[model samples]
Target: MPGITSPPLPAPDLIDIHCHQLSGSDHRQILSRDVHELASHPIAALDRIEALLTNRRYLSLGMHPWFIKHQTIETAFLRLKSCTHHPKILAIGECGLDKCIDTPMSVQIEVFSRQVQLSEELGKPLIIHCVRAFAELLQLKKSLAPTQPWIMHGFTGKPALAAQLIQHDCYISFGKALLQTGSQATLALQAIPLEQLFLETDAAGVSIDTIYAAAAKIRGIDPINLRRQIHSNFINVFFND
Candidate 1:
């Protein structure tokens, strides 16, 4: 085993805009429990994410919808409020609606609305989560002021859905679904404008670079250039300093 290694390929440049790297401990505990598929999982990545950001790589952080069950909703809100000021914390979620999970729709709405209020108050974007709940999320967006930016991460439904979100001024972040062969999200990917789009890994069993590679192929551009565009998109979507 002493020499059993192959040459390492260059790491593809990527910007995972909806990862869970900035949560307070209350949220970290759930990440520690849920993100087991990550080679190092959440705890180690917690330290790694801070370093990656300190080294000037990009990512966003929040309590994803799946973890909402582990703790009191009030405590999660408090944690989100407290962490939004960190220089690396560019957005207010990984929070929104998920129909695939059994977390109550009512609680999800409360948390989503609270986070939206926090985004407005803190002057950051909302990195949202939606499965089959896009209509409800859009309804909530209608009540917020027109100026607040909301970036929807892991978006992979359809071109019409993208059009609807784009019409409302919400940005969409694409992930693994677009990478899968012959998938509808891949078809949808062809329709989205680069300006209203972002990139993410979203706790999926894929690397940010792979997501970037798959996406750049769909965009017919080099991955490095795509990375820069996503970085620019991240800045524009979050509008955080």
Candidate 2:
């Protein structure tokens, strides 16, 4: 008689810290098998959020600073406040200061601060999108004294900036830029501790598997080890698993 066979275990899901593709679009086919993605939706996309929650997808919502330049802040804030407490909303941003944008810095600061307060009130983490305004963002994080984790998504900053953000207990997420040798993202990846690092695909067409491989190569470790460590970080930040 043949020996009894054992069933195979499920594959571990690769955690993508932030991705817009999974949220408001029909591009869901792009998601590879064995991926746990956090979809980020801006304030304008909130209209479809009820459907997202019905589907039980993990999400992050915020009023991005770019919208403040083109739209009314009052209406944006109203929409943002209404959907913040949704059970599927795991984080409160992709919102943060952006000095490079047309939106006045003061208005951006005002809007960003409110989102920070909302994240604090809800006890959810923040998915920060900062550009040329790290100092301001850092200052605000200090002043707010938030207890929840803040992940700076798509980080391509210098090692010093990465170190500073990590010092303040912020998690740094790297994306496609990790493929470029001698890039700031690569340097920062080398400097940051594994526990504080995350990998994201953001709006890029690249797969998270590609990102994991690049990161593991840069860190000189096996891809499985990197994936396991980041899986642990994802649980620590989002699920407390």
Top lDDT model: 2
Best by TM-score: 2
Candidate 1 lDDT, tens digit per residue, 115-219?
788777877777777999999888888876545688887787888998899889888878889778878778777887888877766667676667778988987
lDDT of each: 0.67, 0.77
Candidate 2 per-residue lDDT over residues 1-241, each given as its tens digit: 9999898544446777788666433212111110011123443355454445433246777777766665566666666676677667778877888877888898889988888888888888888889999999899989989989999999999999999999999999999999998999998999999999988888888987889889999999977778778877877887772
RMSD of each: 9.5, 6.0
List TM-score per model, in order.
Answer: 0.75, 0.83
lDDT score for candidate 1 against the true structure: 0.67
